[model samples]
Target: MGCATPWCLATLVAIALALRSGYAVSGLVLVSGYYFPTARTDFWLTSAPAMPLLGDLMRYTSPPIISWAIMPKLMRTLFAPRAIPPEFKNEFPISLALRPKQLRAAAEESAFLIPAAAQLRLQYRVSGVQLGSCMERLTGSSRPTSRRLHAVLPSSLLHLVEDAGHMVTYADAAGIADAVAALAPSAPVRTA
Candidate 1:
């Protein structure tokens, strides 16, 4: 879970920067599970309107979306970390959503991460898949509202697995595995 974010960020950032710097990008296959492409601080808040006011307030600290503003309590919450049970770590989005500590960790990461990612996406605009397409095609699955991936990723590589939810690891592990297998080369990395 933790490794994926850094890996993708590093890969995307490196590729984008390399492209800008005239570095060669070879055999790149970007497979994003569910990416919030926009760098606006409000991107996540706007994505989930039903989220509590705290979520919106927390996100408001980011740039371009700082217009959402913040409160003194929000500031305290942002700096303070509440204790979360170890069990929550295994849960899905709930673990991330309901817990203040987890949210703080995520907020801290995203505060800087999202803006940088937004710059990369905005500047390079690499084409990739919108992971939500998987659920949108189904009759009783989730709503088909997430088309943001198209903004950053190319439509050619974009694939949406049926019924895949936010927790793609558990919801459609096989499908993700297949996509990675097909997109990623089997050869081992070469070291100097």
Candidate 2:
């Protein structure tokens, strides 16, 4: 629970924060790619291309239909008076996504400060999948690559799980558990 796996582009900001802050974070388990604070081209070139028919196919599920299916459970959850933190309660996840320039600024600031804190840091590991065969990766003209990851996290351990995709946890939970155990021997691994 204490460790964090900042998924996708979220790793860009999270890593910057961890490096900039003086706190000795337990670890960062990066899932998928670690986005670098580079130009928009760097990101766009790697993303999947959108096709018209596929786009329509992806969005074909009606919102009302989805609401009808899940609204009752959602309402039940919302009705519960949970002591959630203010940040969690009020925060919109989309608001956290940073533009390339914003990401660059954070990276520059972090790069300057990281040297001072580098010696005091703890474990930082990365894990990616063998195949991200979902529509997004499948549609992309070029194969998905973590070309920038090495430059960003040169010292961190990297793990590639076989037969996994963007939804790595669902594809291979046991592999993830094994990776965690390998990273931190004391970490508990629950099997169902």
Candidate 3:
């Protein structure tokens, strides 16, 4: 599955940038970010808290309850390819993320990505222009995203970094920083 640090928000920002708002956005940075509006089996589980009327009530109920059972695996999965820090294990605000309200936000944001990506896909002209497209090194399903984006935007840069998966910023901060620095108008700077 593709992701983002809340890709729903990223999709919104992409929309804004596409609209050419007062603010300028050079590119969209995705971390485990999903591009297509395609469905995932997990969608129902994560997006359930986003349902109208029931969404509000569901948060304090079954979904969150079930999530508690899965959080350890979820946390481990999110931090894969790297060990979870002791700081995160000992002191991070896990409860805050597990809070009902937080679940609601996550659910809603996850739900928003599909339509948003669809809109972004539709916005691009078939004029053979391109955007830089980088994707995570994980997820078999995610591999097609770059290809699909490249198909639409033929000039898209496909920079595939090995093991660039969920929570990769933490896994390789220097690499991430270096990647960002390289994207700058100026020459790349040392990020480590």
Highest lDDT: which candidate?
3
Q: Is candidate 1 or candidate 3 better by lDDT?
A: 3
Tell me the lDDT of candidate 3.
0.62
Question: In candidate 2, which residue ranges exceed 4 Å CA deviation?
Answer: 1-6, 37-147, 186-192
TM-score of each: 0.41, 0.36, 0.76
User: Of models 1 and 2, which has the larger TM-score?
Assistant: 1
Q: Model 1: runs farther than 4 Å from truth?
A: 1-103, 126-146, 151-155, 185-192
Model 1 gets an lDDT of 0.40
TM-score of predicted model 3?
A: 0.76
lDDT of each: 0.40, 0.37, 0.62
List the pairs of residues colliding in candidate 2: none
lDDT of 2: 0.37
Give the least accurate 10-residue stretch of model 1, judged by summed lDDT.
130-139
lDDT of 3 at 189: 54
> How many clashes (backbone N, Cα, C below 3 Å) per candidate?
7, 0, 2
